[model samples]
Target: MKSTITVSKKVKEVLERKKKEMEIKLNKPLSWDEFFQNIFREEEERIPKLTEEEAEILKDLTKEDRKNWRIREFV
Candidate 1:
């Protein structure tokens, strides 16, 4: 299936400029979906692995913070 919708000349020019920028940045042109996918994939790859202590801290974060809690005791 094919469909076309008219856009303003300014909008078309902006799109062309953005396309050229993206092509140069990525070293190749990409479809809109491909650009988003690459961004998400890069973000997912950059997430740090949680340590045991960090995991425990995340698990222990209660609805309210308790006073005088021992951090080393939990560790």
Candidate 2:
């Protein structure tokens, strides 16, 4: 199935330019769907993944603990 989406001219131009650049670098043709998929895949790879135990610890954190954790992590 196919669907149509509307975008501003500026957004359309940017996407077209990026699509061409990615195709050249990747050495293959891509549909708009494939282009967006590649972009999303790259973004997902940049996020950190935590183990179950780490998630549990986070879930149990108090507001103060979370604030302290953010300060420590960022600074």
Candidate 3:
């Protein structure tokens, strides 16, 4: 799983800076796999992975369904 792609020097520098920023932000040095996962993984699982455009198609819902549907619930 080793490959290389050309990137501009500036782009490479930005990526390195971002890696440092994420390390400080999360209080951990992220592995390459985990770093990409954290960057690309869905931000939340509670919304069924629908984009804002996709969620606008619903035409009907139950009161309970409406009340219970949330991106994330604290309680």
For each candidate in the order shown, give its overall lDDT on alpha carbons: 0.75, 0.91, 0.74
Query: Per-residue lDDT tens digits of candidate 1, residues 1-75?
Result: 656768899987887777678779889988766765776887898998899998888767752355555677554
Per-model TM-score versus the true fold: 0.40, 0.73, 0.52
Specify the poorest-scoring 10-residue window by lDDT in model 3: 55-64
Give each prediction's root-mean-square deviation over alpha carbons. Answer: 9.1, 6.3, 12.4
Please write out the lDDT profile of model 2 over residues 33-65, one tens digit for every residue: 999999999999999999999988878776548
Across 1-75, the per-residue lDDT of candidate 3 in tens digits comes to 987889999998988888888889999998767776777663554446666665555433454478887798689
Q: lDDT score, residue 62, model 3?
A: 56
Q: TM-score of the candidate numbered 1?
A: 0.40
- After superposing candidate 2, which stretches have Cα over 4 Å from the reference? 60-75
Residue pairs in collision within model 1: none
CA shift of 25, model 1, Å: 0.6
What order do you get sorting by TM-score, best first? 2, 3, 1
Model 3 alpha-carbon miss at residue 62, Å: 19
In Å, residue 13's CA in model 1 sits off its true spot by 0.1
